[model samples]
Target: MAPSKGRGGRRRPARPHAHYARHGPQPGLSRLHRAPPPDDAERLHHVGPPVPHPTAHRDPADLCRGQLGAEWHPDFHPREDELVMRQHWSSSGFANTDLDFMLKQHHIRKILLIGMRANTCVDTTARFGQELGYHVTLIRDAIASFSWEEMTATFELNAPLYAHAILTTDEFVDIVNDGAGKGSP
Candidate 1:
């Protein structure tokens, strides 16, 4: 868990993404507010519900590149394009989306994860990797969150217990490029 930017008081509902960015970076979590780094070639996958109402104000092209550079919920009001593979986890990390199958098909023993809601999909997926016995690297800078307190709290306690959370996007990419291996925490 990293320190939060703490932008003033309570965050406005429309600016949930901003709220998360203000809270520094969560290693392995994908941030929606920032533009995708050009060099990312790890078959980058954005795991979240789908486009939300606020994203409708943005363009659809952004959705293809990770939903307005963010992740949206399936039932999010005023639906836009939904990420077909985003999965909903139940303890063991397997979702109807078949993310595990996709990884296996790709021969992806190492995963560079990024997406919305640090404590939800991001954390769940990391946990899922542990369950499936795969090496999961959480690129903190690449990830973001909407819940300030919960995000910080979870990383503070849970991350150390469950996953290897790298602090920057560069570190994340370098680790994968270096053939980083994942094992039991």
Candidate 2:
């Protein structure tokens, strides 16, 4: 007897079009092929005002690039027009980054967090956001994790204790569209 077809019965054929080839660079080509080396101004723009380090005299960009090397540096590059901020200490966004300052500057009293590793970075950031007096909302369905158990733990235990609200992506979007404005926080 033959096995019945199920959801994973067959694989679909690969698309004929090369998406990147049509839109941008060809496959196996370096994205930075035509990019210029980091100049003084570019470095300053990315790294922000120098913090007091043991080697305060050395350029922070040079130091970071030297320590991290070329491959790692490329991974840290922000997309065009994206605001990149550095975080140095705990998993909390506000602990070492300028997130608190930015929030205060923009008068943002609430934050919506969605990201990878629900148990670690997301949870920590949400906790810190609450501690910092912001109304923190975790978009539960939008987060990811390696283990179902970890996801369950975050959503069930830790998130309820730390976060002001736990919402699915659709629920959160609906609320926003229904005129729950920014000032709702």
Candidate 3:
């Protein structure tokens, strides 16, 4: 059966699991199974400066200030009036962050995700959001990755599995505008 149109009259596409199967496992999978090259092994073993445990000895505020400038304590790049949600973990914006509480406060059940490292950060966050019961949408064209493979893995392979909807930036804007009405600021 043909997919039904959404409230905005946009038809969602079929999941592309077959496309993922055509492509092999993501590059990271092979790297994980293989031994490191000799040069990398040497560098790995080399006694450089002792690495500090992430959260063992440092105050959270101090760590934030040290990692980011005092003026910009969080890693996010937000516009003047935009809300910023900071995340420490690679997966899940809600993990170790106030995102869940903030969303609940705002009564926001749906999320539109767009960011860098499509296969890594974006994919991880999308999956986690779906698992947490939020309706997750991905702005496909707005996101990017270091390579085509990575982008494909996230957008084609993982997003259909986790995200409730995938749309282009224009599509998203149109839906928002339609819902908000022409006079909305």
Candidate 1 per-residue C-alpha lDDT over 33-55 given as tens digits, one digit per residue, 9 for 90 to 100: 23242222234333343232122
Q: What is the lDDT of residue 11 in candidate 2?
A: 20
Q: Give the best candidate by TM-score.
A: 3
lDDT of 3 by residue, 1-185 (tens): 23345436645433332332344333322232232212222222111111111232355454353453223312222335445554355345656776666565656566666554567667877788788887887766555555667766776567778888887555555554465422211
- For candidate 3, report its TM-score: 0.55
Alpha-carbon lDDT of model 1 = 0.47
Instruction: Score each candidate by Cα lDDT.
Output: 0.47, 0.51, 0.51
Looking at model 2, how many pairs of residues clash?
A: 0
Compute each candidate's TM-score over C-alphas.
Answer: 0.50, 0.55, 0.55
Query: What ranking emerges by TM-score with the best candidate at the front?
Result: 3, 2, 1
lDDT of 3: 0.51
Off by over 4 Å in 3: 1-82, 181-185
Ten residues in sequence with the least summed lDDT for candidate 3: 44-53
